[model samples]
Target: MTNVSRWAAMLALLFATAAWGGLFHAGKLVLNNVDPFWFTVVRYTGASLLLCGILMLQGKVRWELLREHWRRLASLGLMGYGMFGILVFIGLSYSVPSHGAVIMATMPITTLLMRWVFERQRPQLWAWCVVALAIFGVSLVSGVWRSSTGAGHSTAFGDLIAFVGTVGWIMYTRGQASVSKLSVIEYTTFTAILALPGLFAFAVVATLLGYANRPDPADLIAAIPPILYIVVVGTVLAALAFNKGVRTLGAVHGIVFINLVPVSALLISAAKGSVPNGSEMIGTLLIIVALSIQARKMGLGAKAAK
Candidate 1:
């Protein structure tokens, strides 16, 4: 690839990862206004509806094409959005932001492993080492990174939940399996449409069980801006950018960018009045170094990352 295209691809991946970093904070913010399950319902439904509008503009939506891919779409949607969404928000509710952020950085490693196991596509040994370096840095940022799911022990339990969600996320990544015949927008939108009922069902159950409050207009209005930011930037745009990067740079390069997510999330968290702990600062620098080395390996000058 030309340097300009390479740089743009890297930047897109970075932007996508950065957007994901912000979601922890945003999810916490939105949860204050809407309960966990309802937040999922509202968020995905709005995203799906917006995707419908986008599809309409793209021309007559090819409803039939989706039928051929329905099973794959349904499985990915449920695993990726529906189940993973619940785990992450609930995980964050139990853990501190740092725990969630640090745990998320491990996703690249998990994705890499899945790529190897499922696709039988092993990366270079040096690539594995570089990922390990990033993962070690993430563990430092994790600040007592046990993954026990004992609900009473909040941070550890949260780490465990986040870890489980990462596995579900791994399936989502690997189970894309073959080259998609669908365009990016078509793939993202239709899967989301299929995923809606489960989210609504959870919302209903949560409301009925008194675990969630009924969502009123005022509550939705309070959460609208952040919710919109999430559905647009965090979910849709990020997915597009992420897929672009993966296509451009291949999965190994694209996935390692995830190591930087905790640093981005930590910095964003600090902006929200959560001051950085010392380990976070050190871990951030280590991760940057790791990314810089990896970038150089990709023939992007280390200085270019500046």
Candidate 2:
């Protein structure tokens, strides 16, 4: 790819990941008023419609692609959009944004292990070291090291659920390669549209089972601003940009950028008057170092390919 194209893709991924960082906080706000089940249903519903509108305006709905890959798209949507969204939000409701962000930062290592297990692709030893550094940095940023201070901002159950959500997202990201014939927007839009019915159905079921409460109309109205941010920025834009970046940079390089999630979360918290502890300050530096190393590696690999 041209340098310009590569840079654009990097920018897109940066924007997407940063927006996702903000999403944890925004989601926390929305979840205060609406439970995870209904919050996901509303977010996905709106995002699907907006994505569909964009697809329609482009005059390329690609019904043939949909018909050709409906099953794959459906499974991806269920796993990524439906399952990931619900579980992450539920985890967010029980935990703080920093915890969610730290869990997300594990994606690079998670992807590495998943590939090794499923595809017999062994990463170089250096790659493991880099990911280990990134994870340690994220742990510091998350104050996981300081959990003994008796802060109740996070819980094991919540972190576990969030980790599962991250894995689902990694699966979704990997699944994108199978549908390489589709454009990023097409993939995101179709998966979201296909996922809506299941999302709404599951939400309804949860409400009926009393696992989640049906959000009142006032609750929806109150959370509209954050919900809109979650849909427009987090779901639609982030999904589109992330897929584009992965397509451009390749998954190994693309996934390393997830380390930015915790950094973004820390910055957001700082902006809100929460001072970063010394560990967080140092951890942020390590995360940036890891990202730089990975980016340089990607550049060298791209040059070699050329």
Task: Give lDDT tens digits, candidate 1, residues 1-306.
Answer: 899999999999989989988877787788888876778788888889888898899998888878988888888878878777877777777667666767776766666567688779786787688787866666666555534445323255566777788776656655554426776678778878988887788778888888877789999999988898988988888877877777777665677787767778878878878787676677766766766666567555334675
lDDT minimum window of 10 residues, candidate 2 = 145-154
* Per-model lDDT: 0.75, 0.83
Per-candidate TM equals 0.81, 0.90
Per TM-score, the best of the predicted structures is: 2
Error of 1 at 209 (Å): 6.0
Our tally of clashes for model 2 stands at 0
Off by over 4 Å in 1: 1-5, 119-139, 145-154, 177-179, 205-216, 284-306
Worst 10 residues of 1 by lDDT: 145-154
